[model samples]
Target: MKEKIKIGMIGLGGRGMGLLRLVILNMSDVEVVALCDRYEDRQTKAADKVEEKQGSRPFVTIDYQEVLSIDEIDAVIISTSWADHIDIAIASMEAGKYVATEVGGAYSVQECWRLVEAYERTKIPCMILENCCYGRDELMVLNMVKQGLFGEIVHCAGGYQHDLRDEIAYGYENRHYRLDNYINRNCENYPTHEIGPIARILDINRGNRMVSLVSMASKAKGMKEYIKNEKSHDSELAKLDFMQGDIVTTIIKCAHGETITITLDTTLPRYYSRGFTVRGTKGMYTEENQSVYIDGSHDHYQSWNKNWGNAEEFREKYEHPIWSKFLEEGVQGGHGGADWLVLADFFESVKKGTQTPLDVYDMASWMCISTLSEDSIAMGGHPIAIPDFTNGKWITRQ
Candidate 1:
């Protein structure tokens, strides 16, 4: 493996552009040698950023085939639309390049299986770039679970709670994909943002798997209400009926008897948060209040005594090694610097020819929640069984 990894980036949307900037500025071991996007302006802008940092412009093309044909490109980052994620990942692996894909749930169970089969056949790493797994607080919570501080994890809760009314309403002008998804989908459209961190703490696809799940969605009134009240009353979207619900909650049952709950709370009026919550036999933690409680521990008793535990102290003591290192070396970029850490880890793993933190099974398990939830919701919250993407290999994956 070379010390420097050559890469190509596809789709220059907000998420993709943000990641591209992080790679250019923070990932010293990565060189983005090719840029591909349907939009010429986005591709040119990304190339300018690369050239500004590396003193040389990379190959730019509107066609992704040109990117895959580059002999120097060792990996490709697929940040395209949600529908294109699986197809691009499969193609990248078939072309003998490692793949890193943006966060989105799978549209179909067959697509998830296709990704698993492609990775198994090609033996190339395909990572679903879920940045929340590397979040500072999330990693600390995971370390706490690993260290048995949270004895016998029982349940975990997370959600993508944000207000995206304007973003989705005007998406047609910007070619954003969420508008169409929100207009047509009736299930959990985005699950990775919340489920990724919870899956890591639970060791999903290692010794445990999400056996089944059920989902329920409220009526889709937020977008229409926003279009009528916020936008012009005569706007087209005001009369348009959206299939997605304002709040979609999914309850997942793990094979080990633990349960997890994930919520999709976008398209409504709310503050921004993933709302990561972890509960166990011994203690619990909630991200919304930045609080933690442990049974019989000083923090637990102290909270009873003084109305709150010293969350700052707990964080200082239990910060993950990755965040500790990032803090020492200057934290920068998206999601309070988790983006930089995840991208750097990806490059380092590729350079060393090692498995990524988020492997194909993990990706399949996390992503399949979307389609399964759709099935469950359509059946009026009937429990839908999650497919075992590993096909019994999960028993020994650890």
Candidate 2:
């Protein structure tokens, strides 16, 4: 029988709570041991839910270090703010705990470097929980690419675009930091979700890494408008430091001659879209308008629907037998229930003492865009270099 992986959770905020709920509901092979939150109120509230789910009260604390003090913990689920992810991740890694960080992983380049160093130094796993990688449509696209069905996928475009100012002005309790995260950084600052899964399908950093990125932005329209019409007092608006109406665009180059475009906009109207397009040597597969195009012999192309990224049908026709053996793993969830899928992978990897499919190197590759884009934006759209966290060893190590 496989050993149960004891989990310690840090930051019981909204997203953290959602993931906690997911683990309680979906992951049967794990045990929730510790829960931490800086806000006492949130800690108390979430503890009740945690007790209800686990049928036993967890070791709860307002101090994160207290959660880390649990020597019995085998791993930790970090759902802290973007700014805090790196610090907690490194600390947990140093503490001999497998660390799974919330999306976007780290905020700064230095923090990313630290995360890689911690993994290399400790040999314990560090993962960026880019749940989108497990999403059904995303995974189906990846499976097709791997089968050489889509041929040599060349170019891809994706993003995490949304209107977040409302969440800032009047969204939810405990949303101040999250709302601030949106307006402070360029829109595409968080691009891992839309890119991670597709890139995996195409085997990007697995073979080649992004070399450079050039980021540019437009005016900040939404911020300016909101401030202009805020309230009768308007004092709060004047005090805020904002450059509204900006649309950040980042163009990336992969060493394998593939290119990707990422766009970010929060000072505008909102709609979130994730793209799946594989322009291969013989044909094209797209998640756009819900269709796939296969090259034809005589100017007439074969179009496919329900074949491109149909998670249900793809699951039925999946060529990978391993995905089937783990069928009961990710029962019901989003990203084709990828959150559960990847977590399942983590558990299995831990049990077998094997390398995680998305390893430390994958974490670095996955996080490069946001880090570089920030620099590119800081330099007024100057090109920035991506540090090969693999230390000159380009592709897979060990």
RMSD vs true structure, all candidates: 1.7, 3.4
Which lDDT tens digits does candidate 2 get at residues 189-218? 567776687667556656677778898878
lDDT of each: 0.87, 0.69
Candidate 1 lDDT, 1-398, residue by residue in tens: 77898999999988889988865455777887899999989988988888998888989999898899998899999999999999999999999998899988889999999999999999999998888998888999998899888799999999989898998888888899999999888888889989889888887888888899999999888988888877775467777899999999999999889999999988888999888989989988888777778788645333353534345667777888988888998998788887887887887789998888899898888998999999998999999999999898777778
After the best TM-score superposition of candidate 2, give how far the Cα of residue 312 lies from its true spot, in angstroms: 8.1
Best by lDDT: 1
lDDT of 1 at 328: 93
Model 1 segments more than 4 A misplaced: 298-309
- TM-score of candidate 2 on Cα atoms, chains taken together: 0.87
Clashes of 2: 14
